[model samples]
Structures are given as structure tokens and as C-alpha cells.
Target: MSELKLNAIDFISFAVAGNTFKLKANLIGPNDQFHSVNLDIAPDEIKNKTIGEIEKLALQALRSA
Candidate 1:
């Protein structure tokens, strides 16, 4: 099996709360400050979705957050 390496310059995390799933993107500011954005996507929204579809939604959410 091949290991998948993501060239992510920022931080990301996945979490679940009850029936909703949360995706967060963390950033470091120029002054070494920390900030984060959270996107809560319902399970049904991404259910049965393709990898590409999910990725697209995730990126969109990140941008909006």
C-alpha cells in the first residue's frame, strides 16, 4: 500500500458532535498567532458522496469559514 502524504501548510481536524460532523482548519498568523474556522456539515449532506465531491465541499467550507 502507498502512504498518502498531504502537503498541507496549515492544520486540520475532524470531529463529531451528536449527529453532526465538524471540520476545522487552523491557521498561524504572521505574529505567531493561532486562529481557526469551523464548518459543521450534516451527515446526510456528504453521505454517499464521492471523494472528489467531499473534498470540494470541504474546501468550500474552509474558504467560507
Candidate 2:
């Protein structure tokens, strides 16, 4: 098995959303904040993502705060 280095995530910033704190991203997608996760996958088992898929998911996840 192998580990895949996905994308880099940056903490954009936090804001006061009403009585709670909220975050924002510097790029595309829903801009939701999620805890970091490391997945274990075989080299061949890793999905070959297309440019659009990378953009839609990887970049989106990376840009998310």
C-alpha cells in the first residue's frame, strides 16, 4: 500500500456568524470546513482523477477553510 499526497489546505479565516464562528475559503466550491483526514490506499487503487474532477473535489477541498 502507498500513501497519496493530495492537496494542501490553508486556513483562510474565521468569522462571527451570528452567535457562532464560521469559516471561508479562498477558492471554489461549497467552501465547507472539515477536519483533516489521511487515507490509506494502494498505489494502483488510487482513483485516476481527471482535471475537472481534481478541480471539483481536490482543489475545492484544498481551498476550503
Highest TM-score: give the candidate number. 1
What are the runs in model 1 whose C-alpha is more than 4 Å off?
1-18, 24-38
The reply for model 2, stretches above 4 Å from the true place, is: 1-42, 45-47
Best by lDDT: 1
What's model 2's lDDT at 42? 33
Model 2 TM-score relative to the real fold: 0.24
**lDDT string, candidate 2, 1-65, tens digits:** 01223344344233334332222212322344333422222333234634344334444454352
Instruction: Give the range where candidate 2 is weakest over 10 consecutive residues by summed lDDT.
Output: 20-29
Clash pairs detected, candidate 1: none
Q: What TM-score would every model get versus the actual structure? A: 0.37, 0.24
